[model samples]
Target: MTTTSVGAPKPTRHTADSEGPRRSVRRRSLGDLRVALIFVAPALLGFVLFYLVPTIRGIYLSFTDYSILGNPIWVGVKNYVKIFQDKLFWNAMGVTLEYVLLNIAFQTVIAVGLALLMYHVAKSTLIRGILLMPYLVANVIVALLWFWMLDYQIGIVNQVLQWMGMPRVAFFGNEFWAIPTVAFVNVWRHMGYTALLIFAGLQAIPGHLYEVANLDGASRWQTFWKITMPLLRPVLLLVMVVTITGSFQIFDTVAVTTQGGPINASRVIQYYIYERAFSQQDFGYGSALSVILFVILAVVAFLQMKFLRGNENDLD
Candidate 1:
């Protein structure tokens, strides 16, 4: 018999199985990633075309003397300098700050209060659905509705006051009350949404934690302070950020209700920006103001994130 080498390398069955499956898995993973990218492409394109490009262009235009009819001339900070020198800009800044602070304070308080109430209620689903009705209404519709209700004469608010033997208050006509009145309307429109967010956060807390707290003889107030509040800090910070930014950008309500009238008392930064860009046709100044608002919001958001994250790390 011819002595064929019995030890001549037999095909490694394990190697074939392992290598084939590994290649197949890698190809499958790559295909999945490709599919995911394809799904997200439209959204990415839309964001770039609509938001990102316009934002970059706005920043670039802020440094130039660009208007509707003329070519942009390089002005280098002239627009920003003008903004600093403009007394109206400072006044608008003040009004914006006042609006932001008051709205944040009242909205946070009322939203948190409502969340707490809903948390303890027997019919939470019904309460939440009722509360969210205002949020579902369009902002323009809310503004129009409130505009009628707040009308100085023949409005529901004034009628209610007169019926209750109180003075018919001039809400929009007076400079002192215009900002507050607009802010109050904003709170009314947004409070339900904020409360719903807080309520969701509250509901997400595990019932076992509360049970353990109760076993430890903790009262509701004690449990809230020691457990609920600490756990809810992240959501509260988010609410603060949203409320602050939204309040600072208040425009529609001011436009519909006050139109920056009564000596520009209700003129927040956004309305000022709108007036400069569209009404007055000063795009450079408006772009500069827009940049300023962006910077202010960015700084506040950064600080808030930093502070909150520091607290979170400590807790962890």
Candidate 2:
């Protein structure tokens, strides 16, 4: 052993030198991180200033007694209590739920059908673009346009009905017809975009899968059930979430078209919130209502997620 052998490995000067560069690289990385944070600072600031702060403030306001023009008085859960006891609030809740359920049902069936139809159509882009024109139109404008078209007497639909010897339907004027008409208008405005989303999903299915299905002598319905639906799950989930979220937040259409109707038939929760907040200027109560809305939406979204990915045999 030349008197230099040792049982343990000895540290080398070269190893020490190598560590210097590693330290230098680490310092540079830290510098780069600081620069990256600096670049992101404005967006962080904007989010904190605009969204986070307001959300926190709104949550606090929900427990208070403050009209928009008045100073906030901490009244505990009085606002929530009031809203819970309000019959109109409960009615709005029921109406809103009905709209969401119906909207999602019609959208799911129609949009999926449209997607499947367009998947096979020639010159699809042109057709899809034309369809999307309705979605591109502003909600308020669409509602107003539909309002005119569905009017009791002078509107085109009624005019045509009159000419065809059918009774003029009171689309927005009747309690029973009011909500359905608004919901229909919503679907008409948004169906194209929903179909586009589903179409994209359809396009993503591997062509080889379909070829294999054909080689297996699979019927078209068989192919659809086994291949198409399973593959479209993710996009379907996304569409469900989007539609549900939008349905809960529906206000502009109800406002512009029905104004909560001749009998509050079209008064969704959002419309109810608007009545409390802006119309009556009870900001605190409105905030409480919003908080309830938030909880309802959160629960609904959680359930949707659970339903989408929860099953033990599921293949997400």
Candidate 3:
């Protein structure tokens, strides 16, 4: 045998061979990381500039008494205190909750039905495009279109009602109908997009599972309830979280059509914040409202993910 140093062991061919591959892998990983960083840099920069900076600034402004005319003066929890006692704030909150409930209840049901219809009956891309047409239109345009269509006096809907010997409905003018009409408008706008999202989730489901269900003599309703709904839970929860958050931020439709009319019936929390900020020039209060809304959304999202298990996949 060849003599070696007393304390030093000779390197084996196995070790040498393993090290070469390991070094190459390490270098490749570093290269991949650089490429990834380069690709993500734009999105990261945009997030920092547009989202993160504004959020931090809004939080800072929330604690002050700025009115857009002078420098912000720190006032601690004064704004929060005022908000707690503000009647209009509570009314806006109540109206917003009502709108969210109505919008989500109807939107989720209709979207699920539409998605199932698309999956089972019509898998055409052209059909999907047609369905998504409403969503692609500008929100302002949609609101205006609906506003003219549902007008109490001169709208086509009213004209049809008159032809059918039915009384006219004051869709935007009546307090009782105002919130529901607005909620319906948004539901109509968002239904197709939500359906497409659920459709994607449905696509991920294994065909073999459905085949097995059929072999077991399961009916369509049984298959849906057992296999489809259970596996589709995560997607449903995710969709709910997204839709609920968006519903809470209802502003454009109300702004375009009602302008929070019928005595604050359609005054959502966001519109109230807008009223406080730009309309009244109470930037500090508006900032405070914004911070509150952010916190609420964060809490809601966290609770939904935690309790509803939004991220968990049963497919695993």
RMSD of candidates 1 onward, in order = 10.6, 9.5, 8.7
Off-target runs (Cα >4 Å) in candidate 3 are 1-36
lDDT of each: 0.84, 0.85, 0.89
**Which pairs clash in model 2?**
none
In order of appearance, the predictions have TM-scores of 0.87, 0.88, 0.89
Model number with the top TM-score: 3
Considering lDDT, where higher is better, how would the candidates rank from best to worst?
3, 2, 1
Give the C-alpha lDDT of model 3. Answer: 0.89
The parts of candidate 1 lying over 4 Å away from their true place are 1-33, 122-124, 310-316
For candidate 3, the TM-score is 0.89
Q: Write the per-residue lDDT of candidate 2 for residues 193-262, one digit (tens) a residue.
A: 9999999989888899999999999999999999999988888888898799889999999988778877
- lDDT agreement of model 1 with the native: 0.84
For residues 171-257, write the lDDT of model 3, one tens digit per residue.
999999999999999989999999999998899999999999999999999999999999999999999999999999999999988
